[model samples]
Target chain A: MKAKIYITLKAGVLDPQGKAVEHSLHNLGFEGVTGVRQGKYMEIELATEDKTKAEADLDEMCKKLLANIVIENYRIELE
Target chain B: MKAKIYITLKAGVLDPQGKAVEHSLHNLGFEGVTGVRQGKYMEIELATEDKTKAEADLDEMCKKLLANIVIENYRIELE
Candidate 1:
């Protein structure tokens, strides 16, 4: 099974890296870009074939290592 | 309009950050994990309402600034 994970900063949290990208885009004359929020994307291959088990493990992985729960949020998709 | 961009290392390209994450997962006893790839995800808000124009602009942004096309690949999703 394969898992796709997305880790993003929570609403109300400031993202300096995202701000830098937005600024750069404007400098490059992409004036239509009004906002940018950056996040982490991870693809993981799991040995288990069980979808339920994979989802549970992937969720644990996100909580334990992939995401900082205090300021970030994580979502997982399995295939 | 909103755009979701994903930037990932091309196949066969070495990813040290991904390796580190994989190793950490192993140490943490996520033994079912077989592989890991890390990437960047960005969400951008565009002032334009035209989807076609937004897509074109986003492609240019990826090529010019958001992605290092030499060793990375990017995908853009617009909504």
Candidate 2:
């Protein structure tokens, strides 16, 4: 099984990288773009097929190491 | 309108960050997890509502800035 994790910055977290990218895009002639926010995408493959254990493990992984919890939130999609 | 972009490393590229995360997970007792890959996720808000223009612009953005054509590939989802 595989799990896709998306980690996004919380609202009002001041995304400097996103701002820089947006500026670059506009300078590159992509004038219609705005409000850019950047985050993390992770793909994790599991050796076990137990859905219950996977969910429990994923939650623990996110809280412990995958996310900041203070300024970021993570969502997991199982495949 | 909004667009979500995902930037991922192509196969055969080194992922030191992902490897470190995997090691940490294993040390933390998440033994069933393996093959971790990390990437970037971005959300861009567009001022225009034209879907065709958005697609065209996004392609340019990915090629010119969002992705390193040599080692990464980007996918965009519009909403």
Candidate 3:
């Protein structure tokens, strides 16, 4: 099974990297861009074929190592 | 308009960060994880309401600044 995870900063958190990208976009003349937020996208391949098990393991992974829960949020998709 | 961009290393390219993450996961006892690849996810907000124009501009942005086409690939999703 394969898992896709998206980890993003929570609302109200400051994102300097995102600000930098937004500024760069403007400098590159992409003036229509109003905002930019950066996040982490991860692809994980699991040996287990059980969808339920994979989902549980992935959720645990996100909680333990994949995300900074205090300031970020994560969403997972399995295939 | 909103655009979500995922930028990942090309298949043949080496990813040291990904390797490190995999190693850490293994040490952390996520034994079911066979492989891991890390990528960038960006949410971009555009002032323009035209989807076609936004797509074109986003493609240009990716080529010019958001992605290194030589060793990385990017997928854009508009909403």
Per-residue lDDT value at A28 in model 3: 93
| Model 2 spans > 4 angstroms off | none
Best-matching candidate per TM-score: 1
Ranking by TM-score: 1, 3, 2
Please write out the lDDT profile of model 2 over residues B1-79, one tens digit for every residue: 9999999999999999999999999999998987899999999999999999998889889998899989998899999
Candidate achieving the largest DockQ? 1
Candidate 1's docking class is: high
Candidate 1 TM-score to native? 0.99
Pick the winner on TM-score between candidates 2 and 3. Answer: 3
Report RMSD (Å) for each prediction in the order shown. 0.5, 0.9, 0.6
**Alpha-carbon shift of residue B8 in model 3 (angstroms):** 0.8
State the number of backbone clashes in model 2.
0
C-alpha lDDT values of all predictions = 0.95, 0.93, 0.94
Identify the superior model by TM-score, candidate 1 or candidate 3. Answer: 1
Interface RMSD of each: 0.4, 0.7, 0.4
* Cα TM-score of candidate 2: 0.97
Q: Taking the candidates one at a time, how many backbone clashes does each contain? A: 0, 0, 0
Residues B1-79 of candidate 1 have per-residue lDDT tens digits of 9999999999999999999999999999999898999999999999999989999999999999999999999999988
Docking class of 3: high
